[model samples]
Target: MNWKNIEGLDGVESPGLLVDSDKIQQNIDRMIEIVGGAEHVDRLFPHVKTHKMPEVTRMQVDAGITKFKAATLSEAQMAAGAGASEVLIAHQLVGPKLDRLATLIEDFPNTKFAVLTDDPQAADAINEKCGDADSPLDVYIDIDCGMHRTGIPLGARSDALRAHIDSLSGLNFAGLHVYDGHLHDPDLQQRTDKVKEILGKVALHEKEHPSPRIIVGGSPTFGIWAAETSWHLSPGTTLLWDFGYGDAHPDLPMTIAAALISRVISKPGEGKICIDLGHKSIAAEMPLEKRFQFPDLPDAQPIGQSEEHLVLQTANAASLHVGDIVIAIPRHICPTVALHSHATVVSGGRVTGDRWQVTARDR
Candidate 1:
């Protein structure tokens, strides 16, 4: 279970998260390269919900990506504090959260902060909270482009919401925000057709209303949206890819940049060995087999999983012993990264004695 040439592996503990800095830079470079180059970095507004760290955000900033989209106030704060020119809290804010969003704007006077709003009442709440601020808060009308999530319907409702924001004293209607997360098809042509169908509606609406800008697409439909260069793209998982998206879209240029390092702790049965990774270590949203995969032991089958232990039954069970270190690639890396407090940084094939704090976790 030993990794041949990874320096400083002996010092790392079991069930630790390791992030390769080189791969991260490569992913960022690939995204920018796909979108023409550094000149087109502004077209990308990557979501911060994936990595949720100031260090990672700083890397994007250094790569000429100035705008970011976040799901929480903490993530927005981190992005702004990390020197991003603009930050969009993509989630709707209501009640007291509106005040927190306003405070974030007040705290960072130079950075532009915006939020997504689907409900008219939520728009009113945001205006009321930021009424006395120096400037009106930028707002985007979230459009329900077949996701049926938290967005105003794409017809009259969307128009009415946009008009309502325009009339508000403390809010400025920026544009439309569309997330096509449900369009994750393994077939490239199928995904392309779905994007054409959904984005067609957005184009029609733009013809009537003439929006200043439109932010569209998530990780799955980034390449689809990229073809329509007029719109802004917001792809997050491209930075730290997981097995789920990578396997589905092998044509993508990015590689897996994050992994879970665990150790075999016990051998309780004849052909079974228990590892330290469980639901608490990796993401459990998918089935056990799809949640993570073992590269060293590809024939291993996950037999049992609990809060802190994972039991595997494999023909090579006898080859592993207690304290044997293994690497696991998470199927979904976003939530798997949220479960940990910090990540061990690796660079030049060695652990760099640096730990990145998961800043926006549980915020």
Candidate 2:
């Protein structure tokens, strides 16, 4: 009945992922609008980890977003293969990943690839592995503004690392990479202020030094970085608006573009109905209460979940017969998308008979 619905569900299978093709394009357009307009599309270096499909990456490329960011080599390969002009493997490449990176560069010569480095020794190691003078690897100084997952703090140590990277002959020192994904305060103003405070030092450096680029923030801080033209915006979750983000940032114009389709399989108990959706169907990292939501049936509560079955308790279960369709919106669409091999594409309120491959996942 809402944006997540498809006109026809007869051919659609249960416990499947569905994406609204039109809404995806709309979200891309809105992202462009949020950060100035069509002209500023170049500043948007979206992360393809959410919808990992090459079709989605190509859609962004078609919308004038050539530069991209990814958390894995496979995602970078997917983006480059899908026509990305430049892609950054936002995560550090270690061990065999370096050999894979070199091979990726050789395979996708058309698309320039960059990587994150927070340690000088690791930078030297990367230079030794994949960097070449003829086709040097682009290196960005990963700054741990807050998300201490992988980055150096912005200070003398980071500055020294930048200098060391610059001295390296085989690598092309890029700029600073700050992923404040930890900052997801629902209050827009608080989130804005927090990110600004973290980037304050980097902002000052940019004012003094001219050329080094700064890629900052993700979906939560999209608008915060959008207003500042200098910094590049890398948002992953915004691509396929999820129940988690949609509920958190209601003011944002992004609409729900993907939904989990499930069917009631059995009325096992008086107050419960079992569906096909299970731990394998959706992301299970979140708490049980926040795993997924039944939009049509808000009162539905997950009473049991296993590999291929999810039992829910709701007063409406009595009215729901076997094979009755139920639509679920995942709290975290990125991992949930990875759980599926392909997503059914929906358009014009119906199935488009198209399935986009989840090419960037499982590797």
- Candidate 2 off by > 4 Å: 1-5, 208-211
Across 199-313, the per-residue lDDT of candidate 1 in tens digits comes to: 7888887788889889999988898789765688999999989889999998687888888899899998998999999899999988888889888888889998999999999
Cα TM-score per model:
0.97, 0.97
lDDT of 1 at 50: 90
Candidate 2: worst 10 consecutive residues by lDDT? 1-10
Looking at model 1, which ten-residue stretch has the lowest summed lDDT?
1-10
Task: Give lDDT tens digits, candidate 2, residues 1-363.
Answer: 363356777688878999998999999999999888998888899999999999999999999999999999999999999999999999988888899998999999899999999998999989999989876789998988877688988778888898898888899888888889799899988888897798677778767654468888899889878885557999888889898998898767898899999999999999899999999999999778799988888999988799999999999988999999989999999999999999999998999899999989967
The C-alpha lDDT values of all candidates are 0.88, 0.89
TM-score of candidate 1 against the unseen true structure: 0.97
Top-scoring candidate (lDDT): 2
Q: How many clashing pairs per prediction, in order?
A: 0, 1
Error (Å) of candidate 1 at residue 1 is 15
